[model samples]
Target: MLRTGASRLALRSIAGPAARPAAPSFTPPLQWTSRLSSMASRRPQLPPMRQLTPIQGAVLRRAMVGKIDRKAEDRYQHEKLEPHPELVTTTSSVRSAFSEVATPEAPKDVDMMARVKYDFTTIKDTFDLSAVPRQAYLIGLAGVLPYLATSISTVYCAWEINHSVAGYGYFLSAQTAEQLLHFLEPLQVGYGAVILSFLGAIHWGLEFAGYGGNHGYKRYAIGVVAPAVAWPTILMPVEYALITQFMAFTVLYYVDTRAATRGWTPSWYGIYRFVLTFIVGASIVLSLVGRGEVADHIKGIPGAVDRMKNLKDDAQQALSHQEEGIGAQKAADAAKED
Candidate 1:
């Protein structure tokens, strides 16, 4: 079990056991105990972990990262933040002598666009309500008041018809309230159509004034679409009209947003339209619902009754004319027989 002859001689020399070992045949008595102990301790031991500083740790991690390892302490940092990344540009001209084209200088915006790596703010910081102007906000809100009033009045009228509330009925009779509801439906639809036309006209005005750069057919086509969509809704029935207007409002708002993004309109126009469109859509939905509930309580108008009666009258007249022709033919036959 001894590694070398020196170890065996040293152990023997420390004990001075050679004097007593001569009694044994060939094996020694103290050597057997040491051989058993050495066999028991033959397994290898593990080393302890080393503690490293941040710089050393970063370097170690960097070595493990890419194929061509980066060595600079200032560079290749773990999760490094570089607000202004280094730009390496050559000042000397290297273009061919026969070439006529010259290189253009890069704009500052080009550099600004290339933000630090893994920047979340670039993606997430999109919407800010404070960017919307106060005048546009207030005016847009005010524009929705008519729609709000009509929607509320419609709901209230429906509720009034179902339950006779005497105190409130003193100012407005149930019949009068019903009449007002009838009036409000047309008013609401007409108002919505007008609003849509007005919204569309803004684009035309902007195009005429050259508010944004000349957008050509793009802006002109947008100006025409709003009025085209809105005008037809006025001719539709109450339910259909409101629904069409709702869709128109939503589509127009989306168009406005695109226009803003394209720099054809003010930056705040999208949010302004969004707030107005939301209120207008809600009002339209409320109006439709209120009208629906009220319709259940009231009987539907007998619009087809007159048409049916007119059809019967026309059939009788046709039968009478046929009878007169048959009588005349019979008379002619009798005269021929005589």
Candidate 2:
């Protein structure tokens, strides 16, 4: 029994505080402490942030903070802008800006005498007569025959009338001359108007040929109006009508010359027109001179006046002889009665 008791005491001492209950205190439980220690070991730490110094803060402010103030300083500088060299204020520079650099000189008047001489000298060289077709020349020459014949007949008629009146002492009673002249004068006027209208038709033809547009129509209109102007003048007296025809020819010549100058017609056309118009105008003037009243006025000049005075003296002598014969007959009858 003593031995068993001693063994029990030794076992108790060895087993020590395990047989007693644990007191609750601030100490964590073993499972919780173990979990916390494991989490602390796994977690990552962050680095510390650094603070800026005063000098660095000042530099940042200067570089970025006051840009508006710096721009204001740049805008209002003291120096003036340089002017362009061409815009300098010298007299020559100012004059060059205002004055024209390449103005042409005014045209001088042409010397008419020199022009005439030049034309005469260069006629054959300048004019290529062969360039005109043979048919054109022949037709143009044939057209002049009417004017020539009419003019010649007029002058002959005038000469015959003057001879009859002055030599035979009375006007010619023949109606043939007057009738022919009356017929021819209107014929000439009508023919002239027809020719003028025909010239206008040439413009219309040109318009249709290629120049068809507003300008061509305008040319045609001018031609039409020219003929209308000629038609009304036909009703005037023969002399006045001839004068109008002359004026009309002059106007046509001017217009055609301008047209030729403008390259609307062949170069030689102006010369041909001038020649034809001259002949026509001369014929008209001759016809005018052949009128009876105009011829009488021409014959009233010095030589014709002397011839008329001699005829008057001869008539007076014949009348005096007739009266002397009548008186002698009367005196002889009276003597027979006594």
Which one wins on lDDT? Answer: 1
Residue 36 accuracy (lDDT) in model 2 = 92
Q: What is the alpha-carbon lDDT of model 1 when measured against the actual structure?
A: 0.73
Give the TM-score comparing model 1 with the true structure, all chains together: 0.51
Local distance difference test values of all predictions, in order: 0.73, 0.63
Expressed as tens digits, the lDDT of each residue in 104-223 for candidate 1 is 443344444345632656433444557787777778788889988999999888777766575246457677778778778878988998899999989988898888788878998887
lDDT by residue for model 2 over 230-264, one digit each (tens)? 88756665666678878988888888888778777
Q: Which regions of candidate 1 are displaced past 4 Å?
A: 1-129, 165-171, 299-338
> Model 2, which residues run further than 4 Å from truth?
1-120, 125-128, 165-174, 211-214, 292-338
TM-score of each: 0.51, 0.47
State each model's C-alpha RMSD to the native.
23.5, 31.0
Q: Which ten residues in a row have the lowest lDDT in candidate 1?
A: 43-52
Error of 1 at 294 (Å): 0.8
